[model samples]
Target chain A: MEDTGTRSFVERLLQLDRRWIFLGIALAVVVPFLVPGFKMRSGVVSPRTQSIYDTINGLPAQSVVMFAFDYGPASIPEMQPMAVALCKHAMSRDLRVIGVAIHPQGPLLGGQALREAAEEYGKQDGVDYVNLGYKPGGAAAIKGIGTNIYKVFPTDLSGRNSATLAVMQGVRTYDNIDFIVALSSTPAPFSWIAFAHEAYGAKMGVGVTAVMATDFYPYLQTDQIVGLINGLKGAAEYEDLIRHPSYGMLGMSAQSVAHLWIILTVIIGNIAFFMWRARTRG
Target chain B: MEPGEAVATGMYYLSGPVIGTGVAVLLTLAIYSFLYADNPVYKFAEHLFVGVSAAYGVAITYHMAVLPLIIDPLFRPQNTPSGQPQYWVIIPALLGLMMFSRFFRRYDWMSRWPIAFMMGIGAGLAIPATVQTSLLPHLYSTMQPLAPMAEGRLDLLTGIDNLLLLVGVVCVLIYFYFSLEHKGVFGVASRVGIWFLMIAFGAGFGNTVMARISLLIGRVQFLRFDVPEIFFPPSP
Candidate 1:
């Protein structure tokens, strides 16, 4: 009777309400922030993040780097920190940053990141930076820009003539730009690889959501892209490298706690599954 | 408090930070409510997300692409050809309009012309790029020297990693080769391929988990740190 009772309990445990897991995750996220003097230390930096940092570091001052924002608001959490860190790093190095987005919502997000970073560095707009705004046509637009920037974006996001912007001077195509850093959550990275890098021989790098990061490993190995930054972890690593750990560090602690909770649930659930299976077999 | 004072208090609460926090917190809670069970709040939030996103996309497309590229060139005065209308935009404008023909029963066939034109251009662009960027490079990288040189000698660790990668690639390719039957050596190779596939999938899953957890952490940070600092400051 005791054996049967224990087996029933194990089975019930396996089938417990998913809300329990949700609540656990909630507490895991909340408790860390509530705690005093708790900070998540940055782990060993990946080769990928190091490579991206090196590429940006190597650029000459005032050299243009096109920051392509190809993500939407839904992906802001993962990509925003990356955007901020990259822009911050670039501005600190005195690199001329040109912001553009293939996705509609990307420009709004990208513009915000640019403004914040430029403000920190006391950089002037139309001189040190420019937001070319959102362009349409996806891969075709990338191709057009790579060929002739004027043909693609006749005006900046603010409806100012592209020809008049001081940043636009001597920068008409990918040929003039030093490097391209594409921040994307979709197949936009592949499109950049296919169109911009291949056609124009533009030196490219990518910052992608963690899930999409692995897919770009091949491109990195082939030297098609100079470097890669993978999701929030990658952003945190960059932030740490630049000595400006902000939201990325905070997010990392919560992420680590939440991950531990999930891993624990998985282990417990697996044990219950195995116990139930053994009982059924007997 | 006086009625006038109450009105001022209400106006202060309606400022950017307060309204932003209130809406964001409410929406976040509504979304999170899905963990318990499907509810009206969750559904409302879901619909709002989709509807707002769609409208935003349309508005951006019109503002960024359609108006500037097509409408303005056709209607507005421009430097092209002595301030004359570009007129070339008419061709593309017609093609784009034809896309709407699919909505009508009889005019459905007209949509096919534009569809074919687009497909042809897409295929033309994609084929060479696929070969150069993805397919050819993939093959080239996969066929790397297993014995990597390190300080004028073959490095054991690098060689081992390379050998394993080579084996994984070859086996996986063999597994997909339908012409061969899974017997003896073929079966063993295919089994090894399955193991490699499982490892790759496991790595992918780990990455996906990291991404989802990162997004969750972002929201948690906002609610915990950002919202309070912005909207509900502690009294000095």
Candidate 2:
């Protein structure tokens, strides 16, 4: 007779309905979003993240900061929160914000954020901050910003010339830039540390996709980036640090349930694996 | 609205057709279901994602890298609204063009100039910064309070984490070092190093899953609200 049991095992393995798993994962994540615990469980916070916060927190009012939005729509929720937080913190501290977008969609993405955050902070546009929309060339854009921020983009996203804006007066290049923060999904402007910090001298900070975080930690430890927030987890921690219960925290409460669910799945899967192996050996 | 705005508005309408939203939501959920096991829906979504990402990559490069920087600047020099190039733009443009030659088998050798420039700058960046950013500060930071600081320098947490990190760094470095064959104490260290690497990889795996899941959640939100009136009725 044909080995029916082995065939069945193979068939199950081949034809398993992934929708059930998706349903579980959906429940795991969505449930957490619905009922946010805001549970601040203690975990390792890399020194890189700590320094970034400290660097910004220490800045004085009217300190012109070049904030680069190098990420796109794919990175909206994860990176935007930190970007918004940085803007809020910047405006709250009275820092002059000069926003530049390297991605075409970035200015619009970051502009909407800057607008909402500004409304909350009671900040004016040209007087407090200005958006110098997207530029072409990856490192060349960095090169331009390093030399002259105003030269790169003459007009703000609102079509106001940089020369006319009072906020743009003192700001020009890496020298004028007190702090540079960027949020990237795919190590956007990955060369900032190499080109911006190393070639020139600009104190840098970043919010990168978590996968890229480890690659950067060596740099973070070396102090290339004054602060390094890796992925959503880092964003959540920074949210915690600022005491702002924005999307990061709410997302975290949602994320934790999913994380727990994943852990349980792994545990169960492992047990099943062992049981199968034992049965086979028997 | 201007002619350009009118055209863009038309394109926007064309991009996401009425049925597009519903299909996108179901496919997204289906794609996410792959965590359970391999299924047709998940496969369909995965294929779609792959296709979409590849198209996005091509479009981004064309729109962002080639057109605005290269084609418009050179071919339509007179129409260049941003003023004079003064030869500086030409070098970067030529170098970027050289990078495309790398895709051609017969002409691949021509690509080296740009590749060399990239490598030279990359090498220039790695040495000093790598030492300053990766090595020294990491060594320094690892000296933290596993608990609290002692009077002089209490590195309980910092010391241990740093040590783990350092060992991982050294061992992983050795694995790729390849100067000599793996054997004896060195082999043992490399083996231990691999375990650390695996753990790091595991953490990486978890992070990736989390990111993809987040992206999925976003599409679902778009669908549930945007599509043919699902459970959620448009956020107020």
Candidate 3:
């Protein structure tokens, strides 16, 4: 009778409704935000993220750095913070910033980042920064910039002629640009490396979603890319480096709790499965 | 407050961004309703998302690609920096137009020409670049001094890491080598390769979980912070 009771309990655990897990996740995410001043421990900045920070930090004032916004709305949570942080860091250092997009929706997001950062720094448009906007070709567009940026992007996002913009004064090709960072949720980094880095000898870095982070390890190892920003953790790390806590920092507590919840569920599910299996075998 | 001031405040609440945020919050909730169960609200949200995405994509393509690349350059010459028509732009435009041939069965073969041209250009660019940037560099990096002496002292940690990397790479390659039957030492190596592959997959899965959680946190943030901000505008 005890054995029967044990088996039934194990069976119930095994057949637990998945909605319970969903509710648990929701609570784990929400409860963190409710606690005033809740925050996950700031992580050690990884070598890859530090490399990017160092590169940007080491650049001289007014040196042009192109940020390729190669992601869309779906990646806003992960990619946008990095974009904003990079923009802030670059503009704060008084580095001349240029924004371009390969992804269709990239310009809007890039423009937003540039505008926000520029506004905070009191930087003027057409002088301190310019958004070249989206171009059709992926790798070809990058390659075009290597030869002549004006031909690829004749006008800024606001329709100001490229030649007339003060930001474009000395910037004619990739040779003039100090660094190129591709903030991507796709494999657009590979295209940048191929056309911009390999072909034109341009220095490049990448900011990618966590899912695509592993794929860039080989490139990072080989020095094809200077650094990598991996997903939200990377964004948080950047925020920490810049001393500007924003969305990335805010999300960390919830992220940590959610992860713990997932781990708990996995353990529970596994234990229930094993118990059921042992009873069946007996 | 006066009646007139209250009326003005009501108008202020119905501003563009406030209304947009309200709509966004509704759509977000509709989508999140799927976590409870598959329902009409979720389906409606999904359909709306798809439709909006498609529409946005079309508008952006027209604005960014078609107008600037084709129409402005070829027809609206004054818009060009040189203030002269780029007649050469028609060639690429024609090639782009050729892609539409795939819609008709009889003309599908014509689509092949543009496809072939693209393939040829892509291959021509990618082949050399890949070999130089990816293949050669990876090979060179892998073939490092396994046991390096730093200032006349052996670097054990560096040596071990290099040795493990070399072993892992070789074993993984052997696992993919189906030319010979797996047995004895080869089978053992193949098993090791499987372990490595499993570890890689596990790491990827973990990262994927983190990415999904971050997305969820983003939505939650919108609900908690953004929605309230929409209702109560912060004083400048």
Pick by DockQ: 1 or 3, better one: 3
The local lDDT score (0 to 100) that residue B32 gets in candidate 3 is: 90
lDDT of 2 at A25: 78
lDDT of 3 by residue, A101-148 (tens): 989999999999999999999999999999999998898899999899
Docking class of 3: medium
lDDT of 2 by residue, A88-156 (tens): 777878888878877666777788778877998888889888887777655666766777766666557
Model 1 steric clash pairs: none
Give TM-scores of the second chain, every candidate: 0.88, 0.57, 0.93
Which sections of candidate 2 miss by over 4 Å?
A1-19, A33-50, A154-160, A241-244, A278-282, B1-166, B177-181, B220-236
Q: Which candidate is the best by lDDT?
A: 3
DockQ, all models: 0.58, 0.19, 0.77
Give the alpha carbon lDDT tens digit for every residue of A68-157 in model 1: 999988888899999999999999999989998888888889999999999999988888888888877788889998778877887778
**Per-model C-alpha lDDT, please?**
0.87, 0.70, 0.92
Clash tally, candidates in order:
0, 8, 0
Candidate number with the higher TM-score (2 or 3): 3
For this target, which candidate reaches the highest TM-score against the unseen true structure?
3
Worst 10 residues of 3 chain B by lDDT: B1-10
Can you tell me which runs of candidate 3 are displaced by over 4 Å?
B1-8, B234-236
